[model samples]
Target chain A: MDKETQPPAASSHPRHHAVPPYLLAAMAACDGAWEAPESMREIISSQPTLDKADGPVSVTRTRIATRARQTMLLDQALLHERSTAHQKLTWLIEPTGRLNRIISDAQGVEITPGTLIRSEGQKPSADIDVNRAYDGLGHVYGFLADLFKRNSLDGSGLVLRGTVHYGEHYDNAFWDGTQMVMGDGDGEIFNSFTSSLSVIAHELGHGLLQYTTNLQYQGQSGALNESIADVFGALVEQFVAGDDAAHASWLIGKGLFTKAVTGVALRSMIEPGTAYNDSILGKDPQPATMAEYVKTTEDNGGVHLNSGIPNRAFALFAKALGGNAWETAGSLWFNVIATRTLPENADFATFAEQTLLQARRDHGAGSAVESALKQAWDTVGVVPRLKENDDE
Target chain B: MSESLRIRVVRSGGVAGISRRGILELPAQEPSGQQDPDWFTMAHQALNQLRSIQEPATAPAVRDAFTWSLNIDGEDHVVPDQLLVGPARTLAEHVITLRGSR
Candidate 1:
């Protein structure tokens, strides 16, 4: 952030804490303690019945709350951010009534937001893509606002502007820095890009990333950018379905293609390289581990392909925690971006380390959140440099 | 113009990891003001068109994005993917077909 905009560093900007107040106090008191006291282990484990019950969710809710506070702290760096927190000691309040939707038509051309077909508080257009786009925007915005207290794509109500039917036979969707553009596929291979909630949220996720770290759109960093989009995109889908991480499909662009294409989705977070296998679109070329990472000078250094590694790591992490993926896992990843702890050109190792640090901060030292994140990165073969350095 | 205006498009990155360049290079010029009159007029027109454009700021980068760099003579202009239009669009499509990476 520019010097003019930086907030003074303090613990005084109180709103809400995802990590419970008592836990933060205990963590502060314990200081160097890695694991919780033996008596608290079951609570930290987070299963209610000892046979899988939904007891006090405040433990999970508190961790989410702590990260929520961290998120607000970091978000001051980007855009005109207002704290989306509720009163001092309350859980996050919902952004139920504030939505600014603007849907437009490109008329099969490239003109941006071609004609304003639907504005905020207006009725849905007759076009399916327009309605789908509008609903998708609401879902994602609701996810961030409700879960993380993020106001919008910019952490302030940046109008969720979108244009549908952009260019004939066009087969992609993108955020052009300010607004979104969706394409109607060529009908033979793929359907309209707006068919998938993940696809729409994925494009909007780019807007979120842009406002934060603005990770350079090339090489490994670009892959992280793509992976971040896919990660949050899947979260949006999972959140709307009310699915826990275990129940979530972990597919990035499911339902985007036609049946003739012989593919399930555009990308898969859980199983990279296996999302599609078609005679026309070739194969899904993502690598799930660094061992198979593609070294290329194309796709901005295989940003779309190699993103699968981190994508899988995020999926594994959220599933291991076994709850709403948006709560803990989402907070850690969002912290990495919002904190600017990772460099603009950060590699997978760098990203993994920042997440680890966030896990330690929001959760206690050596907490299960930290353990899950560590295992997730390790399973994907992304051993963080900081971990190795600490081990040394 | 037909012989001298080489409309080249270098397409980089799409679904497939493919990079291809197509050059419709027109004559560099036999510029003593002595050439086929029609061709000379076309070349001047193309040159004027090229000189008229000042490349705009870069557009937001997209995943599996196809970036088109149009090089005319020695002057090069990078066309934002969403904004490719007019003669540039016509030329880019020709290049995409030529490379078969469309």
Candidate 2:
């Protein structure tokens, strides 16, 4: 038979595994079915291997050996066992040292993981976002693992995926339930999202919240979600810069805005309502206290707006503690989100109560931690719930 | 609902964060003797198609994303990232595009 003819055994399965050009001739010369497991064959065929000889592409389709079937069955059982093991370890509990990241170039389009320019363990690319995303994700992973003693976002070392240069003149970054997406700014109001480590951390913080507390994305709960992201965002920045809470700027997106825009930063945790005050962007509408809380149907019930209350509360709580926010205040916040005590529909009042509970539980009743959390919440006018029955 | 339908579509959130709403009201039900069966069929078909679509799972809501809230008669339905698909999508495009002119 000619080398171009496909073997009868291979034709039966119709699932052709790509063979090396040399292997194709050899397999054709043999005129026999190849012996390999179905799953292993699939694994081999998916890899990109060159055909040394420029000829008709070769493929292997063959019968599964008895032992090979057993191995495949064992592999399936092992996969099931692993799945079951991790299923119970939900809430970002798994610790994976290897920070796997994938950076995609959106190419002025709004698509995810658009064109894969970089992958885990690969060297950096010429694109600034590729290298920046890789480094930024690495920094975040290190911060969480080294400081928090936790794994990546979702706790199982979830593959951190990022798309940079997403959309033409896009002006923002977001964590869309899966990966961190960055946009090259219009250069007038904003810069590259990767320009600030805090921005990256802030977006990743959303992922952590998703895998952890999963605070409702509307009203007070939504604000809490945003606040958690901002808090950790600042913590990530401080931890990386080795800055204490007092020294930390507590700005959510410090360098995100360009000089042309009249803004010190996007949002300020230290002084909630003072992030930015500009003509083009309008005045910063964040309210620092419950008295100044904005009641609006917009921005997910002013999530990004009212978050200032808790943001400032956290800043105060951490500053009053007189140390790194990530060490004391940050740990408490992480514990509040990581534990199952936090409900999906938790409001600011409930969150404060939980923080107080965690503080008392962690540091004993009437401890400094408990008082600091109480004072912070009280200062912000968020009265901690006495109990679930009487508070609401 | 009352042999008539009123739809108010509100498009909110985006880069500019400007919100706009437009209302499209269908004529009330004609008496049985005066009813146009073909017109009723068309109206029922359009409304059914619009209400049948459920938002796709895994459809991410990106930054500066647009969300749509459709108040049909009295019941309201909100779709994050506009949940565009089929007749509902076509109607939303028209409602949002022509919101200012109306």
Which number leads on TM-score?
1
What is the per-residue lDDT of model 2 for residues A218-308, given as tens digits with 9 covering 90 to 100? 7899788788988888899899899998899988778878998787788888897777777666677789999999888766777777889
Candidate 1 regions with alpha-carbon error over 4 angstroms: A1-97, A387-392, B1-65, B69-80, B95-102
TM-score of each: 0.72, 0.67
Docking quality tier of model 2:
incorrect
Chain A TM-score values for every predicted structure, listed in order: 0.77, 0.75
State fnat for each of the candidate structures.
0.22, 0.20
Q: Can you give the DockQ of every candidate in the order shown? A: 0.28, 0.13
The 10-residue segment of model 1 chain A with minimum total lDDT is A28-37
> Residue-wise lDDT of candidate 1 within A139-234, one digit each (tens)?
988888766666777655567999999888876677877788888987877789889998899888888887766778888888898899898899
lDDT of each: 0.69, 0.68
For this target, which candidate reaches the highest lDDT against the unseen true structure? 1
